[model samples]
Target: MATIQANDYLIKVDEPWTEFSKFVQSHHYSKIVILVDENTRKYCYNRVKGQLPFDHQIIEIKSGEDQKSISTCEFVWSQLLNNDCDRKSLVINMGGGVIGDLGGFCAASYMRGIDFIQIPTTLLSQVDASVGGKLGVDLKHFKNMVGVFKNPKMVWIQTEFLDSLPANELRSGYAEVVKHCLIADKKQWEEISKYDDLSQINQWTNIVVDSIKIKNKIVGADPFESGLRKILNFGHTLGHALESQLLETENRLLHGEAVAQGMILESMHSVNHGKLSQIEFEEIKSYIELIFGKLEKQRLDINDLIYISKKDKKNFAGAIKISTIDKIGSCIYDFNISPDEIKSLFSQSNFN
Candidate 1:
């Protein structure tokens, strides 16, 4: 079992989880609400149901990036109200990133705020979304356009949940693992950089814990993203824009998939800034393409992506800001890339 002390709470990765039950029982909470999406309800809920010592009700919602919205929040609030949830109640968010984001947003907003814990099931939520307490839903897929920074009481993770993950979902979540290594841990990156058949790997416990350590350390220093924490957005600016633009399309990208492609694109941009060396830039592009596949740059609209990127939450003073790699495991945050530069990059057809 790996544990990290977060800014306000603890992050525990333990199977046969008993801490969750202990906490709820010890607090004698007025009510307990377990929130799940259809997927989690099927694959996760029953597995952990016996752990809760107290009675609780379940709230199930359809799962997807599209469901993380005001309408969903309204539905969650109506359920909380109908079930008589109050300040002393606890909301257990059980599922992947979308469920964690939406459920946390709802619990944080309901009755001003109520206590909640994150029981993230998917690798995406377990490694990236669940730890930071950065809770929110999308604004028309603009990506976390409306959210608040409210830490959960604790976060519990069980690696067994990943067994049910499809190959694509595993690849999607591994993007964050890749991002964490790219930004902070060179040695870790060196270890997993050439991984081809993801199915053969089973040290997920170590990988997940290590990734969380990198993020939690960054978050520990800059919980509000005022400075250091922004580096965690290494491949996210372009990644989020790409995710948003394709939100309604049949070929929609998962958050991590978009970020994987974004890393290759942004790493090339890094070379132009003179921070990332040419050889390293090629390495970034080559490895990312090997794992995530070659990005079909021709399929995207440069103008539309630029428009969506301009709306990125990371911007300040009207500048299109992003985190750029300085080297293999170092990055610079809030680096402003002008619109012309973005247009010019795609126009140059930088991909191989």
Candidate 2:
């Protein structure tokens, strides 16, 4: 079992579901709320059914990024209010990033605050979303425009849930794994890049463990995001913009897919700025595109992307700041770049 000790939060990785039951039994929560979407209810709820210690209420939202909004938060709040949920109630987020983010936001805003647990089902959530205390929903074309930092009491991750994920969904999560290696671990990058078929669930358990360790170390040092923790936003600047801009469009991009693309575009900036070599840039871009195929050729407006990117939470003083890597496994955060530079990078790709 891998355990991450945060300030007061604990992340248990690859642990048996029974541990969750015991933990629930140990607590005297007035009520329990398991937040899921239709997808999770169909593929995940049953896996943990036998291990739940309490009679919990299930709040199922529609499964997709479309449901991640204030309206969804309102619906969740209404559910809690209708059920007479008090501050003592525990909210268990039991799905991928959307569920975890929306559910956690709901829990944090309800009655000022309440305890919550993260049982991240998807690889993306298991390694990235669930660990970070950042919880929010998107606002218009902006990603995570409204959110807060509040740690869950515990985070339980089990790889068994991955067995039900579709191939595309599975690959989407792998992109986040690659991000972890690019920013924090060179050895991991070397190991993961050599293989093309990462479909095996057993093969990913350790990789997830290592990813969490890197994230937790960064988070632990800068829990409030005052400094070092921002490095975790490595590819997220453009990734969030791309994800949010395409969110309402017919051709939407998954979070990891957009991030994979973001890494490529940002690597170009790194090369142009002389921080990353053309060879390394091309190598990184090649591997990412090979694993996660290129995004569809969609005509995009450069100004639209710039506007959406300006909405990134990391931006300060009306300037766009992003985290970039000098080389594999070393990252620098909050580096400011020009919109012209971003446009130049986006121009390199087929978008627009």
TM-score of each: 0.93, 0.90
- Give the Å shift of residue 346 in candidate 2: 3.4
lDDT of 2 by residue, 83-145 (tens): 789999999999999999999999999999999999999998988886769899988745588
Provide the RMSD of all predictions against the true structure, rounded to 1 decimal.
Answer: 2.0, 2.4
Best by lDDT: 1
Each model's lDDT: 0.87, 0.86
Global CA lDDT computed for model 1:
0.87
Quote the positional error of residue 61 for candidate 1 in Å.
1.1
Q: What tens digits encode model 1's per-residue C-alpha lDDT throughout 1-352? A: 8888988798898755666687778988898999998889988998767767689999999988889999999999999999999889999999998888899999999999999899888888889986678899889736688999899998999988898888899999999999999999999998888677678778688889999999999988887778999898988998888887887788789889999888877887888888899998888787887888866666788999999889888899999999978898898888989989888766664553
Error of 2 at 106 (Å): 2.3
TM-score for candidate 1, please give it.
0.93
Which portions of model 2 miss their true places by more than 4 Å?
Answer: 296-298, 349-352
